[model samples]
Target: MSFALKYRPSNFKDLLGQEVLVRVLHNAFNLKKIPESILLTGTSGVGKTTAARIISMCLNCTFGPTSDPCNTCQNCTSIKNFNHPDVIEIDAASNTSIEDVKVILENSRYMPISSKFKVYIIDEVHMLSNSAFNALLKVLEEPAPYVKFILATTEVKKIPVTIISRCQRFDFRRIPTDKLVNHLKVIAKKENVSFDEESIKLIAYNADGSIRNALSLLEQAAIYSNKTLSEKITKEMLGYVSRYTLLEIIEPLVIGNTVEAINKFEEACNSYNPIIILDNMLQIIYEICYFSITKKDPSIFNDNIITHVKNEKILSPTFLSRIWQVLFKGIQEVKSSSCIKQTANMLIIRLCYLSSLPSPKQIIDKIQGNTKTDNNRKALLELLKSNNMQDLYNQIYESDLEVTNYNNGTLNIKTNQVLPKDFHRNLLNFFYNLTNKTWNISIDQNFDISKSSNSCYNKSLDPTVCNILQEFDGAKVINIENIKKEQ
Candidate 1:
């Protein structure tokens, strides 16, 4: 038997990381107020089906309707061995037709031959067809007093609302990584296997909150290590890069050394899968981001990770976010591409290039200088000229304006002309896109253009001529010289 099945939780106390479900089940049994229909929903391998079986044992125990079941009791043994005549287990995925549900409903009507209650445990109940759900709804709406239905599904959304409303729903949460690791330790001791703490943690991390997956990985690692689990063996077995090697790869990236980064990546590719390497880098990036936000290192990672994170100077939250975006996009490309290694190499090059780019704050500081409003106006004009935004430039150049405020991301301009509806919006968007800063552009229209120095020319020149000059730079009308060939 697989380790997952062999170590399945047989009672509420044996279950891990599902306190709410256990509490509710214990209370229901204590009050003898168990619901006729119950729904268990969560991700795969989080023990929904196992909990259903345990509930069956508790309900049909010899002592009757108790929170705890006696393993030696005939009812408990029968249920555990899948031999109980009254306890039915169904896979809704394979039997999704209405006819299959009809059979269940017909059987539910009969009284239990021996047990105190007739229990039905349906796995993947969300796979039931629409008509099957309707049929099941009728049975759930008015179930027999002796009949109990425990429906388990990974996808609660697929179940019909009518059926969901008729049943008591319990959402099972994923087991925490620490809890999973500690549980694995106990299992390792019971199995008389030697394992390293880091190896156990790696297994738990790979399990992604699923106890069954953790156990399965543990079993595989034990077999591969000949009953002794070490970090090296586990890393090799899982095709994962070592933490030191991962740190080595990221060191070059953090330092913005493209050549060194690519060289380290090539070396890592020699021993590790591209996907695994990228995933580890992503994990490191996530940890760095967490550290930046919380000012505390993630506990699951080792001291080496903390030291590496502390040593890197470029891993601010914004810089780390940019790296994450690039890596995330690269992961998708690697997964879909025909040449994984080549694509990964390209991704590494891309990340190295991104590392050299200035962070959002740095760019903003460069654009909007450290001084005040006058500097900001000069910077804005320079940015417009560099980007060749002639229309906006002309508007700013021709307008009679004064800067009122420019600190803390707000750009206030006092202008005379009635600006276009999108003018303020466009200016704000332009500055935001350029510097990654949120600019609040407020236009003050109280200033009179008639009092300005060029007011006479502005009033005398035709609006069309002024517009043409503004739109076209250095435009001139040379005197027309009519040179004609001899006719």
Candidate 2:
């Protein structure tokens, strides 16, 4: 038997992860208040079907209707093998017609042949057609007391809400990596498979919380490595980048060496996935930031890499954020690009060059600091473009909009250009969601830019000019300069 089937949870007590589901079902069955219908939803291999089988065992155990069913009982054994006559299991993906549902409903009306309750376990219930759902809905609405339905699906959203409303729902959680690691350890010990801790962890990480996938990967690893699993063999089998190679690639990335980074990345590329390379880079960024904030090094990384991190001091939140955003974007590019190597190399070059570029705040500050040019408009334009609002960027840039004041989440602007309908409302909404703060944005048609600090009309600090402007009404200061020193 495969490891997945051999190690599958037989009872709620053995089920890993999903404490809430087990607790609720245990209480329900113990209280003799088991719902006539149940809906189990989660990603595959998180034990939705296993839970359904356990529920069957709970209902059919010869002792009584109990949460803890005896595995030795005939009914429990039959349900474990999915051959129980009273507990019928069908994959709705294959049998998804109204006629099929009608037959099941017809059978549901009859008393159990050998058990107290007749159970119908439908897997992938979302695949049922509208007509089939309608037919099943009518029966589920008024189920017979002797009948129980256990519906399992990965895509609960695809199922009708009405159907969901009729059943007790349990959303299963993915097994955490630590839990998966421990489970794999137990399985390996049982099979007498020699393995290392890192190898098991690599399997669990690659499994992405799917217990079945982890077991399958472990089983394959054991066979391919001659019943002995090492980190090297696991990396080769799973097409994962090695710890050494991961650090080697990240060193160049951190130091902003475009050529070396791309060279290291291409050299490491073999049967492994390019996406995993990006994921490794992201992991490095995460570790670096974690170290910078906590002053403690992660054990997974060697001292060599830690020395590299401290020497470069590249783990500042600003620089790390820059690398993180680019690599996160590169993962998708490699996934969609026709040539993974080319796209990845290009991404590496971008990352190396991107580190030297000024951040958005620095760029805005530099623009605003320039006294000769009218920079307020350019600063606002930069903000729009940086946020990827191309439409707003174009409108403001092309129309020659004048921004007079910007401070304390209030944007004061002077513009005569025609804007699209609901422009202010949409802009406010976007800024609010982005900043999580209410913003005051007002456009003026006839504002005096001459008195503003960020405006192009240069204002003076001369006492006479300041007094004249303050005393007079609607007075403008036009390019006052060469004032006396404060000494």
Candidate 3:
């Protein structure tokens, strides 16, 4: 199979994304307005190297600046083969010291050996240290007429503003999924490979907008399927779980079913790898929030689940937003934790508890429904008015009881999820005594001590585990014996 680099487009016409940049470069080259120093900023595998080569070819083409590189010419062929004496490619990552910069500078004063203009292409320019940048500044500021410099880096911010001000900067964005997928389709067809639409989509999405990555993944999928391609093969090759599994785990969280939530998580963990499971869950939550706000079918979320989420209001723009806040923090936690499964399970349980907790809107609705006096409700009203709902929710979620929605009909309240039932009753009664009327009260579900069952907690069953599983009251492993009969 042709890997990404093997089918690498050599000309600007073959470039997938960054049309504006290409147009600008093409116009510049046509106008004979090539800059002495050019800076290309973008992520890796997004054709930075390819673009640099094309620019070099354009400048050195025997047909002239306004003409295309006639691939037949010695200059064009040598540049394409990366053996042109005038076209120098350096890895700044390995040669990042100031001495290396001086060596490059020592040669910058000389004219091209055989081509029209000598080109210096420095990949990963950000790897150059401060001294290295300073060493190269003078030569860049006043370059020889026969010299061209193309600096490419994934990070542009690290390059000193001094160096930045001296170059024509081209910001290459990540290749969009659609464009990448289209390119992938062309490659697949050319390679005599067959793949489903979903397979292409997954590869494109997983590539994260890098053409090189998309090609690499396609290659991996092809190998996994024994030189064939399909949606199932690609998914299995990547070990990526279905969106359904993420949705199933999330449903229990929406309804505050701790046991079922953990159980569903454990069941998914069995077949799918733990990291993949967490990533899929995190992605779904992100999509749920994004789609909820944009109100568009992105084709990633299942249609039926979207319908259900739309109907139940569980996935409201606001609620989904809050869920995202919780999940984002949880994702980081799971990623950093030594025990992946245990950390992820804890995150799931925490999400379920958070879902059961009163939403910001619920708090506002309760405050509005209770207190009669406008002046008394103003304090709680102001709290809601501020968009600091996340902060308040967390404060209320973690604090102790004695929270009163109204004291002497004044809406002064505190909240806690861990308050004892009797203490909670007394706290509510205290508020009622002050108001001389019933006040709305609520208590969220506590973290279930009896329901704790994470793989990390039960490490006797596995040796590679790091954390202790949540200690459940009565949990057992049932290993079924094989039935051997005379057969």
Candidate 4:
């Protein structure tokens, strides 16, 4: 027998990490009011099926309906061995047709042959066909006093609501990591296996809150290390990156050293998968964000985590935010790329490049201090001319437009002309291309062009020619001599 089955809980006292279910079941047994039907739902390996089997044993025990079954009794031993005369175990996943359910329903009508109750245990009950469920519903709704039903499923949502409403439901929760580690410790002592504390913790963490999975990993780790588990063997077996190595990889990135970061990554690549490295980096980034906000390190992490926190204190929140975004985007890239090593290298280089760039606030401060804003209109014209936007420059220059303000990469203008629909979009694109930064161009309609000294209509010129020029900013009156000759 495997560690999971060999160590399965026999009574309510032995069940771990499911206090509420244990309490409810114990109370039901005490009152002799156990429900006719039950539904246990949870993720696999969290003890849903185990709980169901325990319930079956309790209901059919020869010592009466007790939460603590006497394992020595015939009924208890038979149920445990899955060879009881009255207790039936069904894998609903395989027997999903109506005919399969009919056989159980037909037998449920009879009295128990030797046990106190004729129990039926269905695993993965959600896999049953609709017709099969309908056939079983009649028997479940009104079962004989001697019959009991226990159903277990990983996906409760897939089960029909009608069947759910008819049964007493219990939701099984994931085992906590601390509880899992302690459980592994007890098992190690019993199995006479010596393991380091770090190895046990690593096994528990890798289990992802499943007790069965923890034991499975424990079994594998024990075999890998020849019954003496160490953190080094555990890391190599699981392809996990240690906290120290993760810190080393991130240090080069934080310092903006691309070559060193790539070299470190390549060195670690031999021992760990790239995805695992990125996952560890992501966790560190999260811890950094947490430390930056609350000024405290996460308790779950090691003391070396504090070293990272102290080193990253000099980083601005904005800089940390960019790092998180780039790393997050790279995760997806690495996962989908055919060549993981090349993809990981590119991701690291990208982070290094981004680390060297200035934050938004720093860029704003630099622009405010050094940007030439005294001649705002001339600056706008020069920017336009340098970008080969002469047509747009001439259009704006000849029109009744005034440069109200130009500062910190934003250009504010007051214009009377009805600009083209695409003017704003085109201008934004031009600014983005010229500065390699986004520039805001805002138009203020309230600024009266009539009051401007450069207003074309204000000049003492022919009224018709002025109106024509003002309306068409780029129009030229090359010759005024011949309206009649032109006609």
Q: Residue-wise lDDT of candidate 1 within 1-487, one digit each (tens)?
A: 8789899989999999999999998999999889999999999989999999999999999987899998889999999999999999999999999999999999988999999899999999999999999899898888899999999999999988888888899999999999999999999999988988889998999999999999999999989999999988997888877777887888778777888888999998888788989998898888878877898877574764656554556457888888888899889999999999999988988888887778888889865753555666676677788998876766666655556676667778875544455667778888888789887778777634344344423321245655877788986533323456998
Per-candidate local distance difference test: 0.84, 0.82, 0.76, 0.82
RMSD of each: 11.4, 14.1, 16.7, 11.8
Total backbone collisions, model 2: 0
Model 4: lDDT equals 0.82
Worst 10 residues of 2 by lDDT: 452-461
TM-score of each: 0.74, 0.70, 0.74, 0.69
Candidate 4, residues 141-203, lDDT tens digits: the string is: 888998989999999999999899999999999999889999999999999999988889889
Instruction: Give the CA lDDT, 0 to 100, for residue 62 in model 3.
Output: 88
Query: lDDT by residue for model 3 over 237-259, one digit each (tens)?
Result: 88888777778888888778899
Best-fitting candidate, scored by lDDT: 1
lDDT of 2 by residue, 214-243 (tens): 999999999999989998898889877665
The residue pairs found clashing in candidate 4 are none
Candidate 1 backbone clash number: 0
Candidate 4 C-alpha error for residue 325, in Å: 8.5
Better of 1 and 2 by TM-score: 1
Model 3 alpha-carbon drift over 4 Å, by segment:
300-304, 308-313, 360-487
